[model samples]
Target: MLYSKQKVAKAVLVLIFFTVVLIGITLVSLNNGRNGTRSLRSFVSEDTSTSPESIDEALQYFIYGAKYLLAAVKSTVSDNSANITAVSHSITVVKDRMQMLLSEFEHHLHRTEILSFLSLPVINNHNFSYIYNREDICSKKAVKLVFVVPSAPGNVEKRQTVRKGSRGDYVRKNANNTILLFFLGKPSPGSNYLSLQTKIDEEVKEFGDIIQADFEDVYSNNRLKSVSMLRWISTYCSTAKFVIRADDDVNITTVEVVSALERAAETLSNFIIGHKLIADRPSRNVKNKYYLSKKEYPPPTFPPYLLGGLLVYPVSTAKLLYQAALRVKPIWLEDVYITGICATKVYIPILSDPGVVFQHRKS
Candidate 1:
């Protein structure tokens, strides 16, 4: 008879529990026997004048207790062996069923051509007209790093000044190997935001390193921003060895980031490095800004994700993650959607490091 997956899973858990209990019991019993034997030897040695009958009685008691304990353990082992066999069979059935289901899912995805978005049309407002397109670095010379900074439209001048004052020297020193691009979205329509837009346009023309995608600049649209950034990177700056996605407020020097990247260069491919959040649950309070409704995400716990404020990935990993994002349904939480769910699909390893701090600091 076929067993349901739930039943099979329960049986496997039972088998594991029994195995642990059996091992624990065996260890405890062995320790007790050793202590008992030591005590008996000590008693005999200390009481040299003790009668043989007394010693024999004590030995008999010990042996009898040991025999009873051993018999009980043997019975348990026998019963557990039968249970383990049955549980193993159930596990095998479950594994087969899971494999069949996975195959069917893959077939369905292929039939729907869900993974065939290699030629996705560039979103309307995604054209990088005034980009600081460094053709020289994009060619035969290897670009070592690319910094993708997500910035608010209003913070253009402040961010630019901070970048120049703090990280300008480092950028110039590694001019051949490093590039930094600030990503932004259009300000909300109908607001008195034309001045902010004009300022952003002026900066873009002056610096030529800002990428403004077609999307609303809001907290809820960060996931879309992240996806748009990744798609842009995959298309234009795919040759860079490492990519660091960070926020404008983060106070990290280019030197420090490049030093870390250089240290991990040998084994960086398909690896994401950042502070990791493990087993984080969705906030339930409706009033909380981060609250996720049951309809938005039904899972009790989220998969491990890197903090959104700062993340480092090998260029190849960035490409794969972007492709994965195209296939996975996006969640509003950019970090969870792009780095957690999409990264999991591609089996990219997310490594936690304390070096990348996300907290805001004055430059």
Candidate 2:
């Protein structure tokens, strides 16, 4: 077969064009491959129960991996100035996209993780903290404000002394100074609460300038119980910078709580009083928890609600958190519901300060 030089040249050009096209497609495929692997690792790593703290840790890991991967791509493009520089540059572009996607995922994981830990811990009968070290992290700093969560026991047999004060209100701590709130909930019979309510009434009368509310029947669902309480608190602290939210039954010396709250003024509000909650195997069906119901919440796990009784949230943070809590469906996990579902949404940091112990086990 005899072919002209021109014809041979034309055939060669066509062949070269097809070859380049094939190479381009292959490189694109390789870039997509890198992205797929990174995406899988970034979003779907493993199946395990994630606590808020663990979620934060995972975000850190994702961030670190992303940065490392990007650096590797950059180095490949910069250092390898060889025949494959074009391919390397393409690879780097793909790598950057993967990192960006992963970072977004990291943020999402953090949000969910925080909510996972928010179900309010039931600290009614048993104690979560033993002999607590009172002033560990929150020693005397400046003593900004001491906030109290007013707990009303249904039967107030033992609450005679607390009830006999000037105002006969739920917030009978010290009205003359500092801040106070009537965190209304189901009252218990053991604390002589009827009389205590009387005392609280008097206390309110004396220093009525205190911060307080009476949500005695707000929490029929645990999902919004802590949130309801927090909203109750935030309404009072409109001007105050810092706040301390604590339980009535739990033993916390006013002087001590106030001192600690001052130190934490600079730290994040929307903080929960933390103790190692003795987590028994909760009912496999999230609905098994009394606070949880399938109608409002169909999910199997509770939102990260802190124990409803005690916590400290800054006024501004509390407002944002309460709004977020309203947005989420009720999950019946009281504490986690507030911290993870509500507070976590704003990217507000939730912290546990020393001296502000939880589960102190006392009546």
**Which candidate should be chosen as best, given TM-score against the real structure?**
1
Task: Give lDDT: candidate 1, residue 193.
Answer: 78
- Measured with C-alpha atoms, the lDDT of residue 1 in candidate 1 is 13
Please give, for residues 22-88, the per-residue lDDT of candidate 2 as tens digits.
4335343445565434442333344557533543454465456556756655655565444346576
Tell me the tens digit of each residue's lDDT in model 1 across 66-170. 345445444444444444444444333333333332222232223224235434542323333422333343565666777788888888655776567445555
Residue 301's lDDT in candidate 2: 58
Regions more than 4 Å wrong, model 2: 1-143, 153-177, 185-229, 253-264, 267-273, 276-291, 294-296, 303-305, 359-363
Q: lDDT of all the models against the reference?
A: 0.63, 0.46
* TM-score per model over all chains: 0.62, 0.45
Candidate 1: C-alpha lDDT:
0.63
Clashing residue pairs in candidate 1 (N, C-alpha, C atoms within 3 angstroms): 132-208
Cα distance off (Å), candidate 1, residue 32: 26
Candidate 2 residue-wise lDDT at 134: 20
The TM-score measured for candidate 1 stands at 0.62
